[model samples]
Target: MKHALIFRVVLGLILSSCLSSCGMAFRSEWKKAPVTSGVEGKWQGTWLSDENGHHGELRCVVAAPISRKLAVQKFFYHATWKTILSGSYEAMHTVQKQKDGTYTFKGEHKMPDWAGGLYHYEGTIKGDEFKANYKCAMDHGTYVMKRVR
Candidate 1:
């Protein structure tokens, strides 16, 4: 039993290391991605949980839409908790440009039931400000970011 527990711990560490390395590689690629007039760019900000008041640092890389007709933007996010634990995920949201010069977006991402099941996001981007509210079975929160220039 002791040997089995040790093996599991070691395996978990290896998997965590691999995932962290992948995130680092993606961050480098995001830095090289071009900035456009749309929401595509590097973003830095914080995520606040309205339910629990837990907040942390957040960073996102928004990829430009493949076509104007589709209007789907990919958001790659890295979030930290309590200054220690962290995770990364990708979400795609359909963006609609409004007459008032702001863009509204909504999307859903599926996560494990233990985590959140299905998470929904609704947000708006105006100029350099990106604000979004997220909801799920486990927690609901808001993301506030500014385009990195």
Candidate 2:
């Protein structure tokens, strides 16, 4: 049992280190991303849980779709809660451009079961405003952000 705990601790540290590194790289990319009509840029805002009233600061760096056929854009997000607990993760959303110069997207990201298992996101971007609703097995929330210019 003791050995298992030690192994888990070490694994957690390694994962945290990897995530931190990825966050830094995403931030660098965000700095160079150009502001466009599409949702490819840096965003800053807050996430609020409708289930518990918990809220926190949220930031995202959106990358352009790798393939036009797939329409999947990568979003790297760093979120903070309770003023201290923070982590970063990546999600891939299938974005569809609308006729009215807006975009809609939905995606799911799998996390460890203890964390939430799988998080589902549905959102839209309109004129520099990003709004999303997220739901997981443990919680549900809304994210509101504006393009960082």
Candidate 3:
């Protein structure tokens, strides 16, 4: 009788544990993904340093259109800074598309004998404006670029 009682208790505990753990699994409502934004154009904006709020004008042209395949996109990014530094660099990076229609990428910038460092960028497009957050080795900043042809 004692053995049967212990077995019942153990089974009850096991069932309760299983039921409790089932709730821990991820569960979310299914929703349609947003349309991908275009990143092909000439963009001009300002890079505001997060360290000291010092800003610089930045112009970039995404020479190629973002790839729309299932895999991450590889795009050509060329940019020039006017204030904090005066130079231009070209880089090709793979950017991922988010469900919210934004893009995120990480790459290194090397401008010959000029500045070089690692950077992570996240940007969103709305109408003709492109806003992005840049975090580099020395400083982090937000840039707002307007589509110019």
Who wins the lDDT comparison? Answer: 2
Q: Put down candidate 1 lDDT per residue, 72-130, tens digits, no spaces.
A: 88888887766766667788899999999999999999865655579999999999999
What lDDT does candidate 1 reach at residue 140? Answer: 93
User: How far out, in Å, is residue 94 in model 1?
Assistant: 0.2
Report the C-alpha displacement of residue 53, candidate 3, in angstroms. 2.1
Q: Local error of candidate 1 at 57, Å?
A: 0.7
| TM per candidate | 0.83, 0.83, 0.53
TM-score of 2: 0.83
RMSD (Cα, Å) for all candidates, in order, is 5.5, 4.9, 22.9
User: What tens-digit string does per-residue lDDT give for candidate 2 at 1-149?
Assistant: 54564355346535764665766776677678777657998899999989768789999989889788999999888877667556678999999999998999999999776555799999999988999999998678999999988
Q: For this target, which candidate reaches the highest TM-score against the unseen true structure?
A: 2
For model 3, give the 10-residue run with minimal summed lDDT: 25-34
Residue-pair clashes per candidate:
0, 0, 0
